[model samples]
Structures are given as structure tokens and as C-alpha cells.
Target: MTRVLLLGGTGDALAIARALPTTHVYSLAGLGRVPGDLACTVRVGGFGGIDGLVRYLRDEHITLVVDATHPYAAQMSRHAFDACALADVPLWAVRRPAWQPQAGDDWREASDWREIVECIAPFHRPLFTLGREALAHLHDIPASQHWTIRCLDAHPGNARASIVDARGPFDLAGERALFDAARIDVVVSKNSGGRATEAKLAVARERGIAVVMLTRPALPDADRIFDDAASARDALQHWLTRP
Candidate 1:
């Protein structure tokens, strides 16, 4: 059985774990909440840094590594690339492609969190999906404006908002319910492109709401880069079979 290390958390990571050929799997997650019935063995929290990860790769005798973390999770991706290079282990990045708006879609692209805040202020009621940590940016906007914020954790910020705590791959129905309940007029989100959070865009389109989309950061130099679970699994199999 070949030992493989999966950098987990994102939906793609979980998907890849299910698709792996072997049972000798080691998964890492940064979030405290672990997915139930994940196919392989799991480890939570950081690996210190590049040096720590390199040591882990050697100590675990990991044959291959898959950088299947969140697209915004740049630090871990960089560490994985560096550590794999140091350990002479094969590395691959599974990144979902960014979502592009079709005609009649009211979309505005923002470069960062600050820009997202600025873009939302003029709207009467904004639905924010920039993550819980970013709720602080909403403070710049007054409480007079209605805002609906969705996140995995409860938001602890000064902004007066109707916070919805939920995990996603949210469906259009759920997103539409939230939007309707909140009377949302605008949708704000990171272009953290994946099917998981795509429902927000669907809801926005259906309601004819404007969307503030954040751009994704660049990826590191990877031996193989794939956009979906099947491709990622095939790449992993190829690497594992290579002499």
C-alpha cells in the first residue's frame, strides 16, 4: 500500500480522498470540524511550516502529496510545494476553476477584502459571503444598511448583521431562502470558485441581484494541476505508479 498525504479541508480534498486507489491515506485539515466518514485516516492542524512538512513527509514515508486545500489557502500550498521538493516527493494541486458570469449576470470583480466592502456599501441590502473573518470590513458600512452574512462559524464583529451559520456546497433553494428571508438586493462573495459555494451565484442570478466577486490568488509551481476529483485521482494514480 502506497502512503499518500492529502492536504484536506476544501470540498475537492474530501472528494479526492474518496477517489484514491489505496487505503494508506493520511489527511490533514486546518479546521476543527472534521468531516464524517472520510475514506482515509485524518490529521488536523498545521504542519508547522515547510521544514516541519518535509520532516513529516520523510517520517511518514509518504509516497505522494496532493495539495487539495482551499484556493485562498496560499501559505499551505506554498509549504506543500517547498516541502515536497525538499523531500523529493511528487506533488499535485487540485484547484477548481474560477466561475465566469454569463450575459445578464450583474457581477463586479473586487481584488481583495477591502474592495468587497466598498462595493457593498451603495446597495440597499447586501448578502456577504466573504467568510466570517471578513465581517470586520463591514464595520466601515453603517448599521442603517441591512446586511446578511453567511459563514461556518458565528461572526463576532461590530457590524450589525443577520448572521447565518452554515457549511456549504449550498444548493440554490437554500441560498434563495436566505436571500428572500433577508430581502437581499446585492450578493458579495470571493471568487473562491468551486461548486460548493456556487449556490450563492445561482440565487443572485434568479433574484436579479448584483454580485461583488473577489478574484483568486495565483497558484504555486506544481507537477500536476487538476480542476476536479477525477483528474486529481488520475494524476495521483499516475504519480503513485511512476518509478
Candidate 2:
């Protein structure tokens, strides 16, 4: 009788989603492409908020919640934690560790946008891999700086910036070419721990350019937590199948 509700968006979430049974639900925020291949029922859009989520849990008879959302999605993770508590359902999460600075990494931690802007003020050409969030501040780009933003989709950036619509799992050689061609002196990125987009960090490290990394936000505690997707998926399947 146990039914799972997976709150997902990132690749890690998708991997976990693939392991779910047909009866379980995989939910998305309607930003990226919905996978046509998932066996589990895909639920697009939000559940309103904490109250709405609680109602959904009760109505759908969801006994457990898996928070496989992005590391930066602190709000949604909090909502899942609260909603599960209200509905008296178990809440589990996949907490991926953040990427740490290596030997040659010239990394600078930024708690917020203000700090990020200040840290990169000395650079003329900066590459941003922080998604569309940076697009909002197009007008705020400093007079001396030019931004090269790489996101999932293309956008017509203003005079101060240009958008590169591309996906990740970027290779070191390619990233090196990008840095060299753009004359990039700095990189602005979220410390989203994964191999997919980590090439930029290596590229920055070798060039000795500074990387202004956004620190991970503190998330609410879960009933159970897994470090990676494979473990979470295995645990869910075993829990569901075990007598």
C-alpha cells in the first residue's frame, strides 16, 4: 500500500525517477523537457505550496516523499519536509555533496548575488553557468564586464551579455576552447555537485582564473537521506518490495 511521490528536476532526480514503479509519481516544475520514457506517472507543475502538497499527499494516498530536487531548491525541499510532517508521511532526500576546491582551484565563495558581483568586479570577461537567474540582472552588469552565460535554452541577452544555449557533461578540451575563445577571466557558478558541468571548474583551475561559487543553502532534515541517486533508488525499490 506504500506509494511514493518524488519531487524532481535535476538529472539525479531523473535517474531516481527511472527506477520507480508505474504506480509511483514523478513530479516536475515545468521548466525542462518532460521525459517520454519514464514508466512512472509524470506529474507536471506545482502542488501550490505546503498546504496544497499536504492535500495532495492525503488525496493520492502517498505514504512516502522523496525529495530529489536541486541542491539550490531549498524552498521546495522545506515544503516537502513540512508537508510530509503534516500528512504524517516519511520524507527522504538525496543530498549531493558540493564540489570542493582542488589544488589549483582559485575559488571564491559567494553567499549571495551582491557578494558575487563584488568578487567578479575585477574581471572583464566572465563566464556564467548559473542558469537563467543571471539573465535577470542583465542591466546590472558592470560597465567593464561582459558576461557569457550558458543555460539550457537560448535567450537574446542585452549588450552587456550573450547567452550560450547548451547542455552539460562538458569536456575539459571543449571548456578550454570556450575559455580561450571568450578570453574568460572569471567563472560564476553554483556549486551544484555533479560531473555533468564540472569541466568549467577544471578549465578555470588550469587558467588560474577565479571562480565565484555560490554556497549551498541549509536544507531541512529528512527522515532518511542518501548521498546519491543509485542508493536512493535501490532503497526505495527494496523498501517497496520487501515483506
Candidate 3:
């Protein structure tokens, strides 16, 4: 019998997870919310490391591995790649495309947060969609700047920064309201290309605010890579029927 292991955390992962058979396993790192509704078995927490993951793949008899993690989750994705290769099981990745800058957008690519701070020097109010990574830099905030960070986890912001705990699939109107209310003059975001959380980019364009985009980290190659969840699910279904 064919068994699947889904390495998931993003919304794309949830979509693919929904189509999984009861025998397959869906794994989460216990970051945000664990869905109480997945028909497939849900495993929380890490697999220790590459050695541990290899043991799990063989022990669970997982024939195939699907990586539907976030684009920036390079470490987890790397572990999956190595573990699958060691276990001699095929690995497929749901690798979403990165966003491209459109007309009227003032976009600057930053290699890291230090570069981001330098690029955002001219802006007074900056909206950070880079999640909790921004929270670490609250103490570094300049006297002339105010920071707004949006993340899945809720935290009472410090004196210089405000944290907006919310999930995505955000609409343009709401993004506009957020920008207006925050008096945003710039945005800091990762180039995570998806409809969810993309409204902020559109709003940035509309308001003519500069965006400091974080460059995506390099990911290890997989046996197969799917750009979308639906296609990955379809391919997995086909794999299940293979002799």
C-alpha cells in the first residue's frame, strides 16, 4: 500500500493535505494553529534531524514525501530533501513562484535585515509583512521611524513598534485601510508569491510606498517540483496508482 508524508505549514500545504487519504500523514511544526479537521493523521513537532527523519520515513513506510512548506522554510525543506534521498523515497515540492515588481512599484531587494534597515531609512512609518522576524529588531528602530509588523502570533508591541496579529488572504480594501490607519510610508516583505497576503503589495503600489523585499534563500532540488498545490495533489494521486 502507498503511504504519503506531507511536510506542511503554509495554506498551500493545507489544500494538498485536504486531499490526502486517511492512511497518509500530515506533519506540522506546531507554529500557528493545528487544524482539528484533517482526515489524515497529524504529527506535530520535528523529526529530530536528518537521521531522525530517515528513521521515520523507513519506520512509517512512507513511500512518498510532499514538501508544502513556506518558501522561506529552507532549513525544513533541506532536511526533507536529504531524508527522502537517504530513505530512497521520492520527494515532491510545492514551490510557489516569487513575486515580480510591477509598474509604479518602488521595490528594493535586501539580502538581510541590515540591508532592509538601510534601504528603509527615508520612511517614517513602515509596515513589515515579514512576520515575527521584525519583532527581533524593535530595539534597533530609529527615533524617526515607527514599525508595524504583521504575524500569525500575537504580541504586545514595544514602544517603537506595533504588532498586528492576523492571517492572510487579505483583500485590497482591508490592506488599504491598514496602510491608511498605520500611516504607512513603506513596506517590508518577502517575495512570497501567492494571492494570500498579496494585497499589501497592491496597496503599496497604489500609495507609491517603497517596498524592501527580502531575497529568497536557495532551496535544495527535489525529485519533482510543483508550482501549485492542485497540481502536486494530482501528481501524488497518479503516483499512488503506479505499479
Candidate 4:
């Protein structure tokens, strides 16, 4: 039987975990509340580094590695690639596609925090949807710029901007209301490309607010890459059954 180790964080990770056979083990970075009940064996927290991961794979006799981490989890993904190669285990990734701009979208593309900070300089009230992990890199942005930041977790009390602790699946009407309330003049976000957090882009276009959009980091090469759970499941079935 093919013993599988799934690196999980997103909904796709959980979905794939549920679909795979009983030999699978699901692991998370334990960044948030240890998510609700999952079907397979669960392990949480970081695996030290590439050395630790390679050791774990060998010790556990894992035959396959599935990377279903969040799009921005480039470090973890790179580690997985290196570790799996060292361990001689096949690896695959499930990467959600990035969002493309539509007509009327007023966007300024940026590659990193420095670029994003520069992009927002002309605007007064800049709303940052870059999440808690990426927020620290923006210290260079002048204190004179009034900022509004949103994340799933609470701010650390030292934050200079107004922070909103919330999760999303945000809609256009609600996002518009949020922008009005915050008096947001410009928006900054990563191009995570999912329906849940996409409302702000539409609202920004409607309001003619400029958006500083950060592109996703380049993905590490994998044996196979699937954008959805069904396709990943089909590929897994074939691999697991192959002679």
C-alpha cells in the first residue's frame, strides 16, 4: 500500500485528506485552531526543516507526499520539494489558480512588500488584506499614512493601524460597506485567487480605488500539479494502483 503524508492548510488539503485511503497521514502547521475532525491520522506543527522532514518520511515509511498548503506557503513548499527528493518519495501539489483582473479593475501590480508600500504612498487610507504573516514587512511605509489592516487573528497591540479581526467569504455589498466605513482610499492584497476573499477587488473596481496586488511566488516543481480535489484524487488513485 502507498503510505501518504499530506501537508495541509487550505480547504483543498482537508478535502483531499478525506478522499485519500486509510494509509494517509495529514499534517498541519498548527497556525490556527487545530481544525475540526479529519478522517486520517493527524500531526501538527513544523517539521524543523528539510533534514527533519526527510528523517520523518524515512522513519514513517511514507511513500507519497501531497502538498496542499496555502498559495503563499512558499518556504514550506520548497522544503517539501527538497525533502521528498532526498527521501525518494513522489510529491504532488494542489495549487489554486491566481485571480485575473477584469474590466474596470484599477490595479497596480507589486512583487513584494517594498513594492506594495511604494504603490500605496499616494493614497491616504490604504487597506491591507495581506494577512498577519506578511504584515511585518511593511514597516517602511511611513507612519503618516493612515492604514486599515484585516486578518484572521488579532493585532499584537503595537499595531499603528486600525486592525479588524475577521474571516471571509466577503461579498460585494458588505465589502463596499466596509470600504465606506474605513474610508479606504487604496487596497493592498495578495492574489490568493479564491471566491471567499475576492469581493474587495470588485468593490475596489466599482469605487475606482487603486489596488496594489501582489503576485504569488513561483511554485516549486512537483511530479504532478492539480488545481482541484477531483483531479488530484484521480491522479492519486492511479499512482496508488500502479504496478
Candidate 5:
């Protein structure tokens, strides 16, 4: 009986958890609302660090690990890589495909948050769709620049005056309404390519607003990499069936 440890925090993670064997345990970082009941046992919160994860894996006899977290969740992925290696447990990563710029999409790629902050001075009325964790990098933005920031939770930060507490699955019409209402001059967003939040990019293209897109941080190489939920589930099943 190979007990599994699953790192989950996204829609893909949920889907994978649902598909996992009953002996597996699902874990979340406990950042957002507690997820609905998963198919397997669920645990929320951090695993301390590499040492903590290694201990848990050994103690619980976890034979396999699935890293199905957000692409931006580089720290957790790194920890999982190291911990699983130390514990001699197999690990897999499931990544959603990133959004590529299409024709007519005015995308300016920034290597990181520092670069975006440095080059974004010209765009005064900016709309920030970057997640809350990345907001700290924009603290240096000049106070003169009025920013429209959106997040799932209310962020009490001094860098931005306008903060909208909202979650997405945002439609084109809603994005258009937000852009028009905000009178946005530019858009700054992470290349977190998924259907849940791509509407703003469409609206930006439609309005001719410049977009400063931040590239995703690199993740450690995994024993396996999957681009979709179905493929990942199949791979996990194969691994489970092996001696």
C-alpha cells in the first residue's frame, strides 16, 4: 500500500486529488478559504520546511508526492523537490500551460517584479492583476502613480490607493467594465495563464493599453512533468500500479 502526499492549491490540484487513490492525503497551504471536502484525507498549512516534510513523509510512510500547486508557488515546489529527494520518495509536478502572446497582444515581458517597477513609471494609471504575494515588490512605485489593484482578499498596503477585493473567473464584459471604470492607462499582470483570469488581457488588447507581463519563476526539475490534469492522473495511476 503506497500512501501518497499531495500538494494542492489550484483547480488542477483539486481535480488530481479527486482522482488519487483513497490512501492518499491532500494538503493545502491554508491561504484562502478552506476547500470543499476532497476525496481523500485533507490537511491544511505548511510542512515547516524541507526537514519537516522529510520527517512527515517518512513518519507517514508516504511513497509518492504530487506537486500540483500554482506555478508561482516556487518556494513550496523547491521544498518538495529537496524533501522528497532526502526522503527517497518519488515526486511529480503538474503545471498548467502558460499563456503565449497572440497577434495584436501588446505584451512587454519583464524578467521579474524589479524590472516591472523600474519600467512602469511612464504608465501612471495602472491596473495591477498580480496576486497579493507579489504586491510587496511594487512598494517602491511612486506615490504619484495611482494604481488599481485587485486581489481575492483585502490587502492593507500603502503602495496602492485603490484595492478591489475580488476573485476571478472574470468574463470579457466584466473586464471591460473594470477597465473603463478604472480609466486604466496600463496593465501589470503575471503570466498566470489560465481561463480564470485571462479576460483582462483581452480587455487590455481591446483598449490598446500596454501590458507589463512578469514571467513565471522557474521550478526544479521533477521526476515527471504533466501539462494537464488527465495526463497527470494517468501517470499517477501507472506509478501506483507498478511494483
Candidate 6:
């Protein structure tokens, strides 16, 4: 069986791993915390850097590499590209299509994270899905303004707004409930487009809430990027079959 190294953590990566065909898969998870029932053998933490990754590929005799890491994780993507080149191993990047605003959607596009903070000031009740790190930026925005922040982890010191500590793959019903409970009128989120957090968009569409969407950061020069798991699996199979 071909040995495959998968750079993962995001839901897209998990999907890819589940779709792989009979390969001996080794998954690299960046977060110290591992998900329940991960389908393959897993390795947590960084591979030091490019040099380290190159050595690992050679030592383990990995035939191919699939980078299905988060879009925000640009550094790992760059390292994967570089290390694969050095090791002469095939590499692929699996990226989901970004969410675009629909007709009648009240969407304001922010160029960066800082711009997202400024854009939310005009709204009375803002629902923030930009993750926990972004809460500090909104500190001066005002506590009485009513903000709802959702994140994977709990924010202990956050006093300005209501925090929802939850993991995602969230559905429309849950999103609607949260928005209704918070009395949210505005939604702010990064364009970190994937099915994992797409319920926010769905809720916003149904409620006609304004969305302050941040654009995606650029990706590295990956071998190829596919929008779905089936296409990614096909690419992986082609790579494995190639002499």
C-alpha cells in the first residue's frame, strides 16, 4: 500500500481522509487536541519546518502528500509545498469553494480583520463569528451595543459580550436559534468558506441580517486545489498511479 501523509485539522481534511482509497494514511494535526474517532493514525504538532518535513517524508518513504489544512493556515501550506519539492513527492491542496453573496444579501466585504471591527460599529446588535482572537478588536466598540461571539473554546475574560462556546459543523436550526436568542441584527465573519461554519450565512440569509465578510488570504502555489472531496480523491488516485 502507498504511504500518504495528510496535513489536516479542518473538516475538509477529515473529509479527504475518509475518502482515501486503501492507502496507509498518516494525518498531521496542528492543534494539540485531537478529534474523536479520527479515521487514521495521527501525529500531532508541527514537523519543525521545511527541512524537518523533507526529512520526515524521506524517512517514512511517504509517496504523496495532501494538504487539507485550514485556509488560514498559510504557513503550513507553504512548508508542505517546499518540503514536497525537496523530497520529490507529489502534493495536492484541497480547498473548498468560498461563499459568495447572493442577490438580496446585505453583505459588506472587509479587506482584512481590522476592517471587520470598524464595519460593525454602525450596527446595534452584531453577531461575530470571526473566532475568539477577534474579540479584543471589538473592545472599544462598546459593551451595551450587544455582541454575540461564537468560538471553539471558552473566553473567560470576555465581559463585553455574550460568548457561545461551541465547536462547529453547525446547522441552520442551531444558527437561527443563536441569532434569535441574541437578538442579532448584524453578522460579522471571516470568509473562511467551508461547510463547517456555513450555517451563519444560511441564518443571515433567512433573517435578512447584514454580514460583514472578510476576504480570504492568498494560498501558496499548490500542485492543485479541489473544491470537493470527490475531486480531491480522484487527484490523489491519479498521483498514486503516476510513475
For candidate 1, the per-residue lDDT at 180 reads: 74
lDDT of 3 at 58: 95
lDDT of candidate 3 over 89-204, digit per residue (tens): 99999999999999999999999988998999988999999878988888889999999999999998888899999998899999989998999999999989989988998998
Mark the regions of model 1 whose C-alpha exceeds 4 Å error after superposition: 19-23, 137-141, 155-159, 237-243
Name the better of 1 and 4 by lDDT. Answer: 4
Q: Any idea what lDDT model 3 has?
A: 0.92
Instruction: Give the TM-score (vs. native) of candidate 1.
Output: 0.88
Pairs clashing in candidate 2? Answer: 169-196
Candidate 3 wrong stretches, greater than 4 Å: none
For all candidates in order, the CA lDDT equals 0.79, 0.92, 0.92, 0.85, 0.84, 0.78
Where's the lowest-lDDT run of ten residues in candidate 5?
Answer: 132-141
lDDT tens digits by residue: candidate 6, 1-243: 478898887777777677554445646655435755655667777788999999999988897788888777778898899999999998888877788888768899888766876788788888888776566754675755777788777775355677788888899888888888889999988787777788888888877889998787788777777886678877776766878
After the best TM-score superposition of candidate 3, give how far the Cα of residue 15 lies from its true spot, in angstroms: 0.2
Model 5 lDDT tens row, 72-163? 89999999999999999999999888998876788888887678877678878788887684466556668768788887788765645578
Query: How well is each residue in 1-243 modelled by candidate 1, as lDDT tens digits?
Result: 478899987777877777664455646655647766666777877788899999989988897888888887888898899999999998988888889997669998888766876787788788888676556655665766877788788755445667787888799888878887889999888788778889888878876889988788777988888888788887776766888
Q: List clashing residue pairs in candidate 1.
A: none
lDDT computed for candidate 6:
0.78
Which scores higher on lDDT, 3 or 5?
3
Give the CA lDDT, 0 to 100, for residue 113 in model 2. 86
Where in model 2 is the C-alpha error above 4 Å?
Answer: none
Residue 138, candidate 4: C-alpha displacement in angstroms: 8.4
For the record, the alpha-carbon RMSD of candidate 1 to the native fold, in angstroms, is 2.5
